[model samples]
Target: MNVDFVDSAAVQDLLDRASGVRTEGGDARIKAITRDLIEAVMRAIVKYDIDESEFWRAITFFQNGAPEFGLIAPGVGIEHFLDLYMDAKDADAGLTGGTPRTIEGPLYVEGAPLVEGEVNLTDDADDTGTLIMNGSVRGPDGEPVGNAIVHVWHANSKGFYSHFDPTGEQTPFNNRRRIRVDSDGRYSFRSRMPNGYSVPPGGATDRLMSTLGRHGNRPAHVHFFIEAPGYRTLTTQINFGDDPFAADDFAFGTREGLLPVPNRQGDSASIAFDFRLQRATTEKDEGFSSRTRATA
Candidate 1:
C-alpha cells in the first residue's frame, strides 16, 4: 500500500511553519531556500517510500558523526557538481578559457608562510622520492601574470595530509607552501611524491560507498589556489597520469587538461605544467569563496 500525505494541506501547513515562512527575523534568502529544501525532502520521502526505520537510521548516522557528511559530499560528487554548475554558468555567460576549476576537497588550511619564487615543500631527511615541479602563471593570452600567489598543498608518501594525518607524525603545514610568483610568473618546488589513498576504513563515507557500489579512493594529486590581482582566482589541481585512480577519482577532481605525466629519472621525478588565469570582470571574481575553511 502507498501512503500519500505529501500533498495534503496539513503537511503543507506544517512545512510552512517549520520553515519559518512567516518569520522575517532572519535572512529572507535562507528562509526561502530552506522552505524549498524541506518541500523537496518531503517529496523524496514519498517518492522513495522511505520507511520510518530507514529515516531514523539516517538521522542517527548524522547524530553520531556529522563531520563524515563533509567527506560523503565529495565522495558522492556533490562538491564536484558545484564546480560543474559554476562552469556551466560561466559558459552561459560566454566566460570560458584558462585553467579548469575543480572542487577544493575540504583539506585546505589557511596561513601557509609566503615565499618568493621557489621553496622546498619537504625536509631534507625524508627518504621519499623527490618531485620537482616547475611552472609559471600566465594569462589566457599566454603572457606571464606576475604578482600572483600560489597556495599549494598535497599529501605525503602515505597519502596523509598534514594536520589530518591519523599517524600524528606530520608537522604543521608539512608539504604545504605559498609561493609568490616572480616578475616572470615562475614558481617551482621540490617535494615528495604523494600516493593515492582510500577513505577512512569502515567510516561513513566508506559505508555509503559500499551501499552505492562505489569506492572512496582518490588519485595522488597536488592542489593549488592561484590568484592574481585583476584576474579570477583559480581553484584547481593536477593528478598524476600514472595513478590507478587518476581518471576514476572518487571526488571527480580530475579534468582533461589537469593530468600531467611525471617524467622520472633516478630517485626523482619532474612535472611541467603552466597555469592560466582570466581577467575578472568584477571584484567578487578575484577572491576565493566564503566556504568555511580551517585556519591555523
Candidate 2:
C-alpha cells in the first residue's frame, strides 16, 4: 500500500479545486477574484506552515477588524497600490497629463452645499491659517474644462471631519462643498489649513497598526473629486509640503507634483494649483463615478 502525505503541491491543488468553481449565487467576477486570492492564501499557508490555531486566530482578527477596512486599507498601502496600478494602466494607454490621484479616505458625506465658482469652507473662530486654493481645470491638451464640478472637503484644525465628528455635529458639511468651474475653467475656495489626522487610538484600525508596528497618521491635505463631461473623473489630494508627516504619511499617499507649496501673503496663505484631466476613452471614464456615491 502506498500513501502520500500532504505537501505544498497538495495544498495548492486543494485550493484550486475549492476556489475554481462558483457557487449557485456567486457572481462570476467575485468568484474569479476569490479564486486568485484563495490561491495566494493557500501558498502563504503552506509556505509558513501556519497551524490551525494560528490560522483561525488571524481569521478572527480580520473578522473583528472588518469594520475598519477603510482605515486598514490605506494604512496597509492597499489604496496606494490601487492608485499605482491605475497609474500604470493609464501610462500604458497613453492617458497622461492630469493631477496625480490619491486615496479618498473614509469621511466623505453626501449633500454638501453646491455653489458656483467658489465658497468659504469654514467659519470656526479658532480655525488656523486661512487657506485660499484657486485653480484652473484643463484637459490633457491644455484646453480648459468648463462647467467642471469640483467637490472639496478637509478635516478641521483639530483633525476632525464634519458629519463624522462630535465637534462637527453643529455644522454638518462645515468643511465640505461643491464648486463649479466657470467658462474660464477656474474655481477657488477659502478654508483653514486642515490638520493631519490619525486613527482612533483604541479602534480596531489602530489595534492592527500597533500589532503590525505601523503608524496610522495621514498628513495635512485637502480632498477633491473632479468631474466633467468627456473627461476622466479625478480623485486626488493636495499635501502640504511642510507638514511634519509629509514625507512619512502612514497611508503612503504622498506623491511628487501633488504637494503644493503655499504662498504666505500677509495673514492668509494662498496656493495656486492647476488640474489637467485625461480625455475619456472608455465608458468608465466618461462616467466618472465617485466611490462615495452611486450612479443614478
Candidate 3:
C-alpha cells in the first residue's frame, strides 16, 4: 500500500515522530503540550480541508510576524480568554471582592524609575491633555495596603509607547515609571492623556488584519501593574471612555466597572479609583508581580 498523500493516519504518524524529539531531560510537560497541540492542529487541517499552499502561506506569515504576535493576541481575544480562566480558578479557591484583573498589553518594560508618591510622566514641555490619576491600594478586607508599588505606563499623544517606538530606544523608559503608595495606600501621578494607536502600518500584523477586513486599533488607556507584599499582583488598564474607539476596542479590553468617569476642571482632568488586592496563600505567590507571568 503506497500512501503518498497526507491523511489522518499519516498526520498522526508524523506527529508521533516529532513529539519523540526532545532534550536529554525529556521534559514531560513540554512533550505533552507539544503532542497535544500537534493533534489539535492536525485536526484543524483535516476538518477544514486546508490546502497545502494555504497552510504553507500561513506558516510563512507567522514566521515573519512572530514578534507582532504579542500585539495581535489582544485582537484575537486570547488575553481576555486567559483572564476569564484565571477568574474561574480564583473563584474556586475562594478569592473574591477585589479589583478586576484585565489584559496587560505587550508594551510593559521592567525596571521603570521608582518614585516616592507622585511623579510627572510626560515631559514638562510636552503638550498633551493633562490628567491626574489618584488611587489607594487596599486589601480584600478593606484595610489599606501601604507600600504597594504601582507601575504605570502609557502611549504618547501620537499613540506611540516609550520603548517600542522607533526612537523609543533612545529614551528607553520614557512615559513609564513606578510609584510607591503612601502610608495610607494613596498614589497619584501627573501625565497627559494617551491616544489610541493602530497596528504598525506595513507590518506583518497589519497585512494579515487587512486581509481579514479588520483594523487593529486599541482605545486610549493607561496600563498599571500593581504589586504589594502578601498579595497577588494585578495587571490592568484604565480605558478612557471619551475615545471614539472606547466602546469599540479592537482588543476587547473595555469592560463594565473598569472605565472611570473623569472629572474635568479647566485644563486638567482627574480620576479617583481604588484597588483591592487578594491575599497570597503560597510561597510562590508571595513575591508575585505582573512581570513575565502573562502570556501576551
Candidate 4:
C-alpha cells in the first residue's frame, strides 16, 4: 500500500518552486543543489513511510543539538566522505602524492602561541607521561621545507580538549602549540600523552550513535596543520597505533600514513614521523581553509 507520487507533475512543480526555479533571485548553483537535497528528502519520506512522530522527533533532536551538530556530522561519516570525494577529484586532476589529507575535527582554535625552538605542547605536563614527538617536513622531491609552520593540538591526558572540555579545568591553549621547523626541516614537541575520549553521555550524538549500534570513541591522537611557502597546506593527524580504537575511530580520522607507533620507555614515550607536501600552484593552496573554527 505504498503511495508513490514523487514522479507526479504536482510534486515536481512543488520541488521546482521551492528551489525558486521561476524566481529571478538567488544563485543558480545554490538553487540546484538545494533542489536536489530536498528531492532526496522527499523521496526518503515517501519510501520509508516516515511517520510524523519519527520526523518530529528527528527535528527535535537537532533543534536541541546545536552544540553537537558539527560533531555529529563527522561521527556519522559525512565529513570523511568529503575527504574521500575531494581525494577522488584531486586524483582526477593529476594532483596526488605527499601526505594524505584527513578530516579536521571541530576542536581547532586559532592564534596559538608560536615558539621558536623545540616546543612544549603542554606547559604543566608531568614527567611520567611526557611524550616527545619529532618530525621532519620535506617537499615532494625529498628536500627539506625548513620554513614550514607545524600547528599541533591534542586532548589532555584525561581525553578532554581545552575550550571544548565541559569541566573547564583546562586553561587556554593547554595542549596547543605552533612550532616552527628548524633549518633542517625538523620540528619536535613535548606533550602529555593524550587519552581516548568518548562523546558526552546521553547527548544527542551519543543517543543517535547508540541507535545505530556504533561506539562514540576516538583513539589517542594528535592533530596537525602544516604549511610552508610554495606548498599546499596539509591538514592531518596521527593516531597512536597501539590504541585499541585506533583502527575503529569514530571520527574516521585514522589513515594509513597517519598512524605511527609510539615507543614507550620507562615513564615516557617517543615517536617520529616525516611529512611531505605537494607543490602549490596558487596562493590559496599555501593557506589554511576559511572554514570557521574556534578561537581562544
- The candidate scoring highest on lDDT is 4
55, model 1: CA deviation in Å? 0.7
TM-score of each: 0.95, 0.88, 0.89, 0.96
Best by TM-score, which number? 4
In candidate 2, list every pair of residues with a backbone clash: none
What are the runs in model 3 whose C-alpha is more than 4 Å off? 1-10, 21-25, 167-170, 265-267, 287-296
- lDDT for each residue of candidate 1 in 83-120, tens digit (9 for 90 to 100): 98999999999998999998888888899888875688
Off by over 4 Å in 4: 1-4, 125-128
Better of 1 and 3 by TM-score: 1
Query: Which ten contiguous residues of candidate 1 have the minimum total lDDT?
Result: 117-126
Q: What is the C-alpha lDDT of each candidate?
A: 0.88, 0.81, 0.79, 0.89
Record all residue pairs in model 3 with backbone atoms less than 3 Å apart, i.e. clashing. Answer: none
Better of 2 and 3 by TM-score: 3
Model 1 alpha-carbon miss at residue 206, Å: 1.1
Lowest lDDT block of 10, candidate 2: 1-10
Question: How close is each model in CA RMSD to the real structure?
Answer: 1.6, 3.6, 3.7, 1.4
